[model samples]
Target chain A: MPVIEVRDLVRKFGDRTVLNGVTFSVEKGETMIIMGGSGCGKSTLLRHIIGSMKPTSGSIKLFGEEITTMPAPQLEQLRLRFGMNFQFGALLQSLTVGENVALPLVENSRVDPAIIDLIVKMKLELVGLTGFENLKPAEISGGMRKRVGLARAVALDPELLFSDEPTSGLDPIMTAVIDRLTHDLTRKLDMTAVVVTHDMVSAFRIGSKMIVLGAGKRAGTIIAQGSPDEIRNHPDPEVRQFINGEPDGPVPLKLSPEDYIDRLLGHPRQKGVAY
Target chain B: MTLRAELRTFFFLNREILRWIFLGPFQGRPVRTAAVFRQMVRIGVQAFPMTALTSLSIGLTLAMQGAQELSRMGASAYVPNLVAVTILRELGPLLVGVVVIGRSGSAVTAELGTMKVGEEIEALEVMAINPVRFLVVPRFLAMLVMLPVLTVFGDYIGLAGGWTICHFAMDMGTATYIQRLMEAGHPLDLYSGMVKSFVFAWLIILISCQSGLGVSGGAEGVGQATTSSVVTSILAMLVANAVLTAVFFVF
Candidate 1:
């Protein structure tokens, strides 16, 4: 069975449909990368799959068990099998790095304190943050905080990992390092990963399967999906524009001048006029 | 958010907190006592000096004013009775509640608002850790226990302030002052104030935490939520105090 499956997931905020009939699945040990421009519902989709959000319609299954309507206790039990690394690191500011990494283990298990400490050290070392465990999250650089977040996400050796823009703010070298760590974690530990990122470099480096979500008219629907090479050679011009970092593309950067003027003047759109 | 929506969210959050505190232990998820102790220090012990100063000031002012007014009627000896009845029955708990709302309640709102904005709450959720259990219950438990304790201390300090004025300004003997205070206060007076403090604690924590957890946007949102939390808590406490006072004394 696939490790994770989402079918016909639709999430709407009032009349604005953020995600429209989205569907995807990830098999065990496969790394699926979801790439999209800002406000394209990448994070929202990830939240639904992880059970943090309830879809307006459709189904999601984790480990062959339906999770979309699962009870809170059951969903929490399912959550123990996976880990999510948020975009901003989201480390509890009051906690030391070691305590932050050790949180899940200590809360969920009856492990000895010494053993938990040892495990925390090992996790920190995995992210190249050894001996820095005593410092609070605010003491670390943004890149270092993200690394600590990654370490904490994997602290439980979870079977599935969901990362949201893991390398967005990092320098090139740090980005490469994070990408390498993610690659190593998946390859060596046989873990399944679903990563949401727009960093083309990191996406190409670690993504075995890739999906590009559309913006503007396309909105939340996937515009392209396949292996990394398939996405690289996609016939879709929008996909090409996104992957190549082109400034000009089918992607709408701003509203038309007429629409902007109408919005500024608090006037409804004229009848029979295209947005 | 609409008032109806906000009210719904507040009640739902309260139910979740109650469930986590009462039922979580049976499900092998107990409230961490260590965190509760830590919050107690932050919420109660650290607010000690401020609580002390405020209670003393209120007590001293009450005595001085009561003496000045009663002396006009040649009933200056009734100053002890006035101070004792008022402090034990109302001002002690009310003053401490306001102090805590200012000191610790706003702090909880700002802390949780920042966490919500930064997605730390979501992170906790994804880790299978209920944020209500991990965060709110500790503050709830700490405030529930400490508010009453602080009120008791404040009541005594207020009585002491009244005693100081009685002894020096009124030229009344300390024994006479204590006797009048004892005669004026009933056991029900202290109990009524304790009941008010308990209710105020619940109001402060629930309002502050709900505002914090409901925060959106960013830094400015945190600031707005904290301000709202403080204002709502004080209003709720005042309303609750009036209701409880009527229940105990009038009805």
Candidate 2:
């Protein structure tokens, strides 16, 4: 069975419909990359899949159990099976790096303190942050914080992982390192992953299956979905524009020049009129 | 948010805190006693010097004021009675409540609000750790246990301040002042003040934590929540003190 299945999910904030009838599923051991422009509901979709958000309508099933209406206690139980790495590190500022990573094991497991300490070191080493565990989050660089966040997320060796912009602020070399870790976790451990990222390189490097979300009028719906090669060579101009990082395309950047002038003047435009 | 909505959130959060404290242990999610102790040090032990200074000032001011007025009536010896009654029955808990609301209460709101905005609370949830259980309950337990202790300590310090004024200004012996103070105060006075402190502690922690957890936006939001938490907690404690005073008076 698919590890996660989102069907006809709709999320609305007042009159603004952020996500409109979006649907997708991820099978076990597959890495699904969700890519979109800013404010296109990439993270919103991820939040819903992870049960952090409740949809306005529709369903999300994790491990074949319906989770959209699950009670909080039950949802917490479901959370134990998966791990989510936030966009920023979101490491508790009050905790040391080792304490941050050890939080999950300490809270959820009955492991001995010595073993928990060992596991924390191992997780830190996985993220190349060994011997740096004694430092506070504020004492570290932004990139190091993000790596610590990853270590904390995977501390439990969860069966599934959800990462939001896992490589956004990192250098190209570190981005490759994180992408490799994602690859290793899924390939070696048979873990399922759903990542939301704007990093096309990282997306293409690790994504087994991919979905490109549309922006503007198309807002929360997928514009394209398939293998990396399929998305790379897709026929859709919008998809091509996003993947190639083109400045000019069908993607709307801002208000048109005429509209900008009209807005500033506080007047509706007349057809074919020069400002 | 509307007042009704704000109140609903407050009560809901209160219910969650109580549930986690009482029921979580049965579910094998017991409150972390270590975190509770850590929060006590932060909220209570660290707040000692400030509480001490404030209570001392209030006591000295009350004694001086009461002596001046009573001396005019040729009743200077009544100063001990006045100081003891006021400190033990009212100013003790009220002043300490204000101190805590200003110090630890605002801190709670700012800390929680930052956590909410940074998604640290969400991170805790995603790890199957309930934020209320892991975060709020510790603060709640700490405040509940420590506020009364602080209030009792403040009352004694305030009495000492009053004694300083009486012994030096009135030329009254310490034994005579102590005897008058004991004669003036009933056991109920201390109990009533303790009761008020407990209620104030509840309101302060609940308002502060709810404001923090409800924060959005960013740094500005944390600042706004902290301000609101302090203001609301003080107001709530004052109102509760009035009501409790009336209950004590009537009964």
Candidate 3:
């Protein structure tokens, strides 16, 4: 059985649907990457998998337990087995980097203070932030913050890990560093990772299986899903365009809030309008 | 959002905050007593000077004006009674509440609202930490413990301001003022103000927290939430004050 299975997942925010009938599964020890453009529901799908969001109508089974309708305590218990790294570091502003990494251990477990301190040091060391643990997140660079987030996420040694745009807003070198960390941690820990990113290079580098989410009319569905090499050579134009980073493709530029609303409400084309 | 939805969110958060306050320690590992105390020092100790200064000025103004009117009507002897009762029962709680709402309540909203917008709240959720229990409970408990104490302290300082005016400015003599205050000062009057301050503190924190958690967008949203926190809290405080006064004193 897959470690994470989501079937017929539908999430609606008012009149608009974000994740529509999305179906996917991540087997144990496999790095499944969910790659999509902005507003393509990649993060939404991640939220559902972590049980932070309830689907409008669907079934999500985490470790063979149907989590869609699970009680609050049970869902919280399931979340313990899962770790998530957000887009930004999202570390507590008031805390030092060491405190931020140790938060999960301090809050959820009964570990001794000395052991927790040891674990915090080890995790920060793994992320190349050993001596800088006392520094606030604001005191560090963005790349360091992302590394700290990764350290915090893995503090519990979770069975499954998730990341949302881990290398976003970083230069090429930092991006490579984060991608290497993700791959190394997954392999060393024998952990299943589901990552969401629009960075094609990072996705291909770390992903064992890649699912490319479509945009515009085909927004929520998986346009293509395969190995990184297979996705690199996928026949679909949307997949080709996204992977190749083309500006002009089947994806139309939504310029304004009014345009988005028009698309959402399905406005009819203007009569006799010039293209 | 509509009024119904906003109110629903407000009350729902209130229920959740109260649950975390009373029941969370029993259910979870243990309450973070240190965090609560830290919040008390921030919310309580930091506001002492501002509360003292503002309430003092208000008392002096009230006494000066009351003395003028009483002297005109040859009822100047009633000035001490007027300042004692009014400041103890009314302005003490209201002024302190408004000041705290302006100071601490807005800060709470902005702080938590920024956390919400930054995905810090989402990060907490992923870690199986209840944001309300971790964030709001400490501030809520602090406000509960401190607002009443400030109100009572404010009553004393305000009475001092009245005394300063009567003794120095009016030459009414400290003995006469003390005698009037002794005759007029009832524990029930102070109790009513304490009760009102407590209720006002709860309202301020509840509204501010709800605003914080409900924030979205970005910096603009944080500013809007902070403003709304102050406005909604003051309005609720006024309405609550009227209701409590009628319930405790009028009936």
Candidate 4:
């Protein structure tokens, strides 16, 4: 059975429709990467999957149990089976890295204090945050902070993992390091992972199966979904433009000289934002 | 935000906090004792000095002012009665409420707002922990317990200040001052102030925490929420005190 399945998910923020009829599924041990430009609802979709958000319409099933309708306590139980790493490393500022990583084990289970300490130490070492455990999150660099967040997320040895924009602001080397860490953790644990990102390198390197959210008229809908090589050599110009980060293509750029002049002259939106 | 929106959010948050407080014990050995104890120290014990200083100074001012007016009318002996009644019924609790709102209320709001913006609140949620149960309940209980204790301490210090002025500045005998003070105010007056302190503490706590939990954007949002929490809490406490006074005394 699929570990995560979202069907016909539609979310509207008042007048704006953010995710329109989105559908996807993740099998056990599969790393599915959801990638798109900004505002394509990649993060929004990930939040819905994690039960942090409720879709305006549709059903989400985790482990074949419907999450969209589960009560709070029950949903919390379901969340325990999964671990999530957020963008910008959402570590508690007041806690030491060891405390932050140990939070899950401490709060959820009745394990011995010694066992909890051992688990925390082991998780931190996995993320290369060994002796740095005593330091607070503010004392750490951005990359180390993200790694600590990863350690905390995986502290419980969860079977399913979700990461939102894991390597967003890091330099190329740090990005590669994070990507490798993610890949190693997935392979080592046989965990199912869903990652949302705009970083093509990180996405392509880590994704076993991939989906690209289309721009313009096809916004919030999948334009392509396949293996990494299939996505790397896809035919769609919009998909190609996004994957290659090209300035000019099916994906729209800023206004042209004539359009800029026209907009300055008070004529608004002469063309759609994306073609 | 509109006043109506703010009011709605405040009511909802307070209801949720109260729900967790009353309904939480059945959830199997709920253990937040350490958290509540820490909050009690932060909210009540550490506030003693400021509460004492404010109450004492206000008592002195009231004495000097009342003696100045009553001496002209040859009713200077009534000064103790005036000081006792006023401090017990109004200034002690009100001053303590204002001090706590400024000091601990703003701090709580800022701390929680930063937590919310930094995604610590969301992190708690993702960890299968109820943020309200973990964060709000301990502070709520602490405020309810501590405010009255602080008010009682402040009331005594205020009475002491009044006695100091009466004995040294106004040349009144200590025995006469104590007798008049005892005779002037009923125990109900002190009890009424305790009730007022209780209400004010909850208002400050609920407003500040609601502000913190609602914070968005970034550090700028935290600043805005903290400012709003303090301003709104002080105003609400004053309005509430007037109502409670009318209910307890005037009616």
Candidate 5:
């Protein structure tokens, strides 16, 4: 059975619809990447799957159970099975990196502190955050913060993981490093991973399956969904244009004049080059 | 539609609120001194000048008004009694409470609101920690303990300011002002002021933290929560003070 199933998910803010009739599924042990432009509802969709936001109308099943409508306690119980690496890392500023990584084990599990310490160190080592556990989030570099967040996300050995823009604000080299780490963790643990990212490179590097959001706005629909090769060769003009970084495409319709001109004049746009 | 369902929902929310109160502030078992010290600096020390200044001005203004009115009635000697009673019983605690509601209250809301918007709160949830129990409780405890202490300080400064004005500015004898102050009212009036300070403390922390954690948007959301926190806490304090006054005096 699919590990996650989303159907007819519709979300709106005031009169502006963000997601409309979006649907997809991810199998166990697979990495599914949701790709879109800014405001295309990729993050919104991820929030929906995580039960952080209520869909206007839709259904979401995690492990064949309808988790969308689950109560807080039940949803919390369900959350234990999965972990999330936030875009900004979101490690508690007050805690040391070691404490931040050990948070999951400390709060949710009965594991001994010694074991948790060992595991936290091991996870940090895996993400190249070794020996820096004593530092707080503010004391670390941005790239290191993301790694610590990743370590914390996998702290409980979660069977599933969700990362929102994991490579955001990092150098390309760091982005590649994070991408490799994510791929290695998923393969080694055999865990299903869902990543919402706009970075085409990172997405292609890690995504086994991909969902492309936004065609003409007005509640972005899934314009395309398939494997990396299939997505690169997607028949939809919107998908192709988005991947190729074209100037005149489905995206320019919503762009500000400055953004349009910046792109047209080849003034480096801060392309959503993030995980 | 069922009573059972409604009750169940109510209890769940109530538990969440309680958990936030008890567990939120100490999440990660934050070192008490560090957190309390931060709050003390923020809520207690930083608030002192404003509290002192506002209370002093209020004292001076009250004495001036009291002297003017009592002088008209040829009872100018009652100025000290009036100032002592009003300052000790009401304005001292109440003015400090309002100032805190603006200062510490808005700050708590903005800080927590930013954390909520940034997903720091959710990250805590995923770690199996209750954000409320760990983060909110300590702050609640700190505010509850500190407000009364600050109120007492404000009351003393207010009385001193009032005394200085009456003795030097109003051409009143120090002995007369001192005597009137001593015979003004019962000790219970001052005790009630301290008690009200505690309630006002809870009101500040509760409203600010709740509004902060309730934030949904990004930075803009934190701003909105801060504004709402000051407005709500001040209003709540006013209503609470009136009720407390009535209960203390009428009953």
Candidate 6:
């Protein structure tokens, strides 16, 4: 059985539906990537999977237990089995990187201080952040912060981990660095990971299975779900265009009537072409 | 959830408050001393000057009013005693409460609200640190500890201002005014003021910390929480003062 199972999940913000009847599951050790545009509900779906937000309908099962219907105390207890890396790194700004990394050990477990220190150092070193544990989040570069977040998420050796926009503000090289660290951690630790990202390159690097979310009425419906190469070569024109970064495609930019007319006049269309 | 769950949450929140206070002694773990101290200084120390100035000015005004009223009855000598009792018992405690609500109360709310928005609180929870115990308790302890000290300072400055105004401006004998103030004000009266100060401090911290933890939405949510903290603290302080006054006077 999958470690995490989300079935027909739905969420709406007032009149607008952000996630519309989405269903997916992450197996025990699979690195699944949820990919989409800015408002495509990838983060929303991730939130539900992590039990941060309640679904409008359907159910979420974590480790074969129905989480949505569990008591608050039980749910809190169940939360320890999972870890999440926020989009902005979300490391406690007031704490040193070491403190941030050791927080889970300090709070959740009664491990020895010596052991915690060793584990914290090891986790930071794994992310290539050795000896920089004394530095605050502000002192580190954005990519380093993301790495620290990854270290913290894996601090307790959780079976399932979720990362939201892990490469949001990093340079391309740094993005790859974070992506590789994530890929290496999952592979080496034999852990399950669900990553949400818009960076196609970073997504392709670590995503064993990728799910794409589209817009509007089908906001969170999986437009495509397969291996990276399979998604890149999808038969769906919308998926193909998005993958290739094409300007003129099935996903047309909505323009005002005056601007639409201007575009038509500025670049004279073929005689038989429709506006 | 049932009523039992609500009750459990209440007790849990209270226990969390005490946990943070006790945890302060064990500095081996990550201690947010600098942050707490900075917040206390910003909320308590920086607010001192304004509280003093307001207290002195208001004390002077109260003395002036007392002089005018008592003079009509040929009891102008009573003005010093009236102002002394008023400053130590009512004005000092109440004014400090209001100042803290504006200064520290709103600050606690905004800080916690931003932490909520940034998911720092949730991160703490996932790390198995109870956010209420980790964050709210320290703030609550700081405010509770500082307000009484600040109130005493405010009372001293206020009485001195009243003495100065009565001695010089109101044309009363300095020695006589001091005699009346010392004779009329009891140690019990001072005790009442101190007690009220502690209660007000608790109210300010409780309202601010609770409102902050209650924050939802985004940045706008934080702003709303800050406003709510101030308003609620002020209201709670006022009600607590009234209750304390009734107990002190009636009983």
Best by lDDT: 2
Using lDDT as the measure, what is the rank order of every candidate, best first? 2, 1, 3, 4, 5, 6
Rank ordering of all candidates by TM-score, starting from the highest: 2, 1, 4, 3, 6, 5
- Model 3 lDDT per residue over A80-173, tens place: 9988888788899889999999999999999999999999999988777889988998899887888799899999999999998888888898
Badly placed stretches (over 4 Å) of model 3 are A171-173, A247-275
CA RMSD of each candidate after superposition = 3.2, 1.6, 3.6, 3.4, 7.4, 5.5
User: How far is B81's C-alpha from truth in model 2 (Å)?
Assistant: 0.3
Docking class of 3: medium
Candidate closer to the true structure by TM-score (higher is better), 3 or 5 = 3
Better of 4 and 6 by lDDT: 4
- What's the lDDT for candidate 6? 0.82
Tens digits of per-residue lDDT for model 6 on A40-77? 88888887776768888988999989877777657767
Per-model DockQ against the true two-chain complex: 0.82, 0.93, 0.69, 0.75, 0.46, 0.50
- Stretches of candidate 6 off by over 4 Å are A112-118, A130-135, A139-141, A254-275, B1-46, B64-74, B166-179, B216-221
Candidate 2 chain B least-lDDT 10 residues: B16-25
| Residue pairs with backbone overlap in model 3 | none
- For residues A1-275, write the lDDT of model 1, one tens digit per residue: 99998899899999999999888889988899999888999999999999989999999999999998899989988899998888888999999989999999999878999999999999888778999989999999988888899998998999999999999899898788889888988998889999999899899999999989998899989999899999999999999999999887798567878878798879877779776
Candidate 4 chain B lDDT trough over 10 residues, lowest sum: B22-31
Docking class of 4: medium
Least well predicted 10-residue stretch by lDDT in candidate 1 chain B: B242-251
Interface RMSD of each: 0.6, 0.5, 0.8, 0.8, 1.7, 1.7
Model 1: per-residue Cα lDDT over B1-251, one tens digit each:
99899899989998999998889899899999999999999999999999999999999999999999999999999998899889998999999999999999999999999999999999999999999999999999999999999999999999999998989988999999889988999988999999999999999999999999999999999999999999999999999998998898674
The TM-score measured for candidate 6 stands at 0.83
lDDT score for residue A76 of model 2:
86
Per-residue accuracy of model 6 over B1-251 as CA lDDT, tens digit each: 35577446546676767655676357343445665676678778888988888888878888889888999999988988998899988998998788878977898889888888888987776665668767876676678778998999999888888888788887878788888989989988889999999988877887777778778999999998898778878887889999999999985
TM-score of each: 0.94, 0.97, 0.92, 0.93, 0.80, 0.83
lDDT of each: 0.92, 0.93, 0.89, 0.88, 0.83, 0.82
Candidate 2 docking class:
high
Q: What is the DockQ score, from 0 to 1, of model 5? A: 0.46
Q: Candidate 4, residues A230-249: lDDT per residue as tens digits? A: 99999999989989999988
